[model samples]
Target: MFSERFIQYIKYEKRYSAHTVTAYQSDLDQFMLFLNNPGNADPAPEPEITHPSQISYHHIRNWMVELIDQKMLARSVNRKMATLRKYFKFLLQEGVIETNPASRIQSQKIPKSLPVVVEGDRLTEMLDSDEIFSADFEGRRDKLIIEMLFGTGMRLAELLGVKEQDVNLHDGVVKVLGKRNKERIIPVNTELKNLLKEYIDLKKNQNFDNNSFTLIVTNKGAGAYPAMIYLIVQKYLSNISTQSKRSPHVLRHTFATTLLNKGADLNSIKELLGHANLSATQIYTHNSVERLKSIYKLAHPKA
Candidate 1:
C-alpha cells in the first residue's frame, strides 16, 4: 500500500520516466520481498517485517551486503540504494516514519571510466560508404539509426521517444523528451535534415504503420526497443571500433567529443546534449584531452 502510493507519486508528481518509475517500484518490491522472507540469510527479522516503520538501517545494510554477495556491481547496488533513500524520504515526508533509515547509508564508490568515441573521420567515412548499407527499408533505417544517434547525440531512450512531429527537417531541429520527462531541442545539420525527410517519405511510401508515432521503427513498423537498437549499433560498429563498448551510447559520446574537439563550449554542448548540469557535459572535455594525448604520442618527436 505504501509502495503503491510511492510509485504513483514518483510516476506523476516527480514526473520520472516510466522506465525509472518501474525500476523504483521493482527495487521496493524486492526489498519488501527480502524483508518478508530473507531465505536463510542472517538479516531475517523475528517476524515478517512488511511495515515501513519496522525497517531499520540494519535491514538495508544487510540487503546491500546480500546484493554484493550476489555479484551486483557497485553502480547497480548504489542505484538500488538510491531507490531506498527516495522511498524512505517519501515515507518520512508523509509522516509514515519519523526519520529516514536510508539517510544513514552512503552510496558505494563507483569507478570512473572515460567515455569511448569513434574517430570522427573514420565515422564519417563509414557513414558515407554506400556499400555498407543496402537500399531496402531496413537498410535505410539502420543507416538512419546510426546517423541520428551520432548526429544528435541523443540517448537511446530519447531516440525511441522521438516522434514524427518532433523531427522538424525544415527547422533543422529535433525535439526530444529526455530523462525525468524533461524536453529539450537539439539542432540537426543539413545532412541529418535531408536524411529525416527521406526516411519520412520512405515510411509514407512503404505504407507502414505509424510505428506508435515514433521516428525510429522496426522492420514491422513497430517502435524500436533497446536490444534492437543495440544490435544495430553492434552490427555496424564492430568493424570500426575495437573498444569494449560498441553500443549506441558510443555514438552519443562520439557526438559530444567530436563537438568538443571542434571547439564547442561545455555549456553549449551541455544544452545541446540535454544534460541537466554542466558537470555531466564536462566529461567530453576529458575525452577531448585524451584524444590530443593520443595524437601527441603518435606524431611528437620526443625521445
Candidate 2:
C-alpha cells in the first residue's frame, strides 16, 4: 500500500519519466520480496518483516549484502540503495516511520571512467562520405537521428520526446524537455536545421495518423521508442567507430568533447547539453586534457 502511494507520488507529483518510475517500482518490489521471504531461500531463514515501520538498518544491510553476493555491480547496487533511501524518506515524511533505515547506509565507491567519444575527424568523414546514409525515407530519418544527437548533445529520451512543435526552423532552436521536466532551448546548426525541415516534409508526406505529432517516427509512423533509437544509433556508430560503447550517449559525449576541445566555454556546453550543474559538465574537460597531452607529446622535442 505504501509502495503504491510512493509510486503515485513520484509519477504524478515528481513527474519522473516512465523509465525512472519503473526502475523505482522494481527496486521497491525487490526489497519487499526480500522482507517477506527472508528465510524461504534457505533451510533455516530469518524472521519476516511485516511492515515498513518494522524495517531497520540490519535488514537493509542484509539486503545489500545479498545483492553484492549475487554479483551485481557496485554502481547498480548503489542505484538500488538510492531507491531505498528515497522510499524511506517518503515514509518518514508521512510519519509512518519514526526513523529512516537507509540513512546510515553508505554507497559503494564507484570508479570514475571517462566517457567514450568518437574522434571528430572520423565522425566527420563518415557523415560526409556520399551514399553512407541513403536518400530514402528510412535513410533520411536515420541520418537525422545521428545528426540530432551529435549536433544538439541531447539525451536519447529528450530527442525521442521531441514533438513537431518543439522545433522552430525559423528561429533555429529546438526546445528540449530535460530531467525533472526542465525545458531548455538549444540552437540548431544551419545544416541540421535544413535536414530537420527535410525530414519533417517527408514525414508529412507519409500521411501518418493525426494523433502522431512526434518529430521523429518509426517506419510505421509511430513515435520512436528507446529500443529502436538504440539500435539505430548502434548500427550507424558501428560503421565509423570501433569503440565497444557506440550508443547515442557516445554521440552526446562526442558533441560535448568536440566543443570543449575546440575552446567552447564549459558553461555554454553545460547549457547546450541541458546539464543541471556545471560539475556534471566538467567530466568532458578530462577528455580535453587528454587531447592536450597527446598534442604536447607529439610536438615536444625534449627527451
230 in model 1: Cα distance from truth in Å?
Answer: 0.8
For model 2, the stretches where C-alpha displacement exceeds 4 angstroms are: 38-44
* C-alpha TM-scores of all predictions: 0.95, 0.95
> Best lDDT goes to which candidate?
2
Clashes of each: 0, 1
lDDT per residue as tens, model 2, 91-205: 9999999999999999999989898999878887877777789887898899999899999999999999999999999999999898888899999999899999999998888
Whole-model alpha-carbon lDDT for candidate 2: 0.90
Displacement of the residue 239 alpha carbon in candidate 1, Å: 2.3
Q: What lDDT does each candidate get? A: 0.88, 0.90
